[model samples]
Target: MQRKNSILRSSKRGGFAMIMAIILIVVLTTIMALTLSLTSQTTKQTSDLYLREQAVLLAKSAAELALLKVSGWNRATSGCLTSVNAVYPSTTNKIFDINVTMKYIGLGCGGSADYIPAIVTPESNGTVLMDVTVTSDPGVSTEPIRYFRRTLQKL
Candidate 1:
């Protein structure tokens, strides 16, 4: 009877150990899954931030380029307002593109109603309002990254 009782106690202890092991496995699996999910979310957020910054920089540069173009133009010969649309790389990929619209907002020696007659014109020197939009394609996301910059330059 003593020997039988000892065997029974041993069997019960073995069963308890198996249950503990199963619980431990479940806890570890849950932790691992949570870690993976957090990592994925962090990666996506970082990528989005980077793309946004890039678009902003591109827009700024494009605006500067537009300003140069306007300054070089002969005000007497060209129209007061001009719209220029361009795509970067000029390749099939078209990863980034910019649209620059310059509108005359001042009435000076060269400013005329032929450019923007309906809009209010400033009474001072010739001023051009440039609107630059930069667009970038993020392959992973459904929506593209876009940045807009407006600059008023005097010519």
Candidate 2:
């Protein structure tokens, strides 16, 4: 009788251990799945952030370039280059499209420029408003990224 009781107790303990093991495996598997999901989400967010930062930087640089063009322009000699458009790399795998438009304030660009001064005020004369827009190419970027920067420069 003693030997039989011992055997029964041992069988019960073995069954309990197997149940515990299964529970532990299920918990661990759940944790692993959650971790993988979070990791993929983080990667996608990082990629989007990087792309947006690039677009913002490109817009800023484009604004500066527009300012440079305005500074070098001789109003008396020729019409101002009111608008500029070009791809960043000018390559087949182009990633960025930058567009810049300019408006003169305070001066009458009357017939002198293809872009007439949008705002003509005595106080704002010799001032320029440059709008620069940068967009990630749809062909390359999975997520759309667009950035616009406006600069008011006194020339």
Candidate 3:
């Protein structure tokens, strides 16, 4: 009788240990799943931030280029303000577009005033607004990363 009782008690202890091990395994698996989910979200946010930064830089560069062109504008060189130009970067895989326009002022003497010294006529000065877009292709998802920006030349 004594031996039989000892065996029964041992069996009970073993069963309890097996149940605890299973529960621990389930808990660990839950924690791992949560960690993986959070990591994925963080990675996506980082990628988006990188793309946006690139787009902004491209926009700023285009704006600066437009400003330079406008500053160099002269009636003798460009002939007229209605003329414009588009410039593209000459780098490998460089994806940016730049467009510029111009305006000028002309003097006139046809006003209601008794004797107008001069009249100011607005001529199209070459100033441009630039749009920049960036894209990143991540193979994991069906959608690709995209960023857009709009910037105008400084007066």
- Ranked by lDDT, the better of candidates 1 and 2 is 2
**Cα lDDT tens digits for candidate 3, 42-126:** 8888866665566566556655665565566563654433323333344343333334333322312123211223234333222
In terms of TM-score, how similar is model 3 to the real structure? 0.54
lDDT of each: 0.73, 0.79, 0.50
Off-target runs (Cα >4 Å) in candidate 3 are: 1-8, 73-155
Give the worst 10-residue stretch by lDDT in candidate 3. 107-116
Candidate 2 lDDT tens digits, 1-155: 45455666676898899999999999999999999999998998998898889888888888888788888888777756678787877767788999998877755666534234555445666787788888888876567888888888787
Model 2 segments beyond 4 Å from truth?
Answer: 1-4, 7-12, 111-123, 139-141
Residue 147 displacement in candidate 2 (angstroms): 1.1
lDDT (tens digit, per residue) of candidate 1 on 23-95:
9999999999999999989888888888788778878888878878777777676655476777766757776
Mind sharing the TM-score for model 1?
0.76
Better of 1 and 2 by TM-score: 2
Each candidate structure's count of clashing pairs: 0, 0, 12
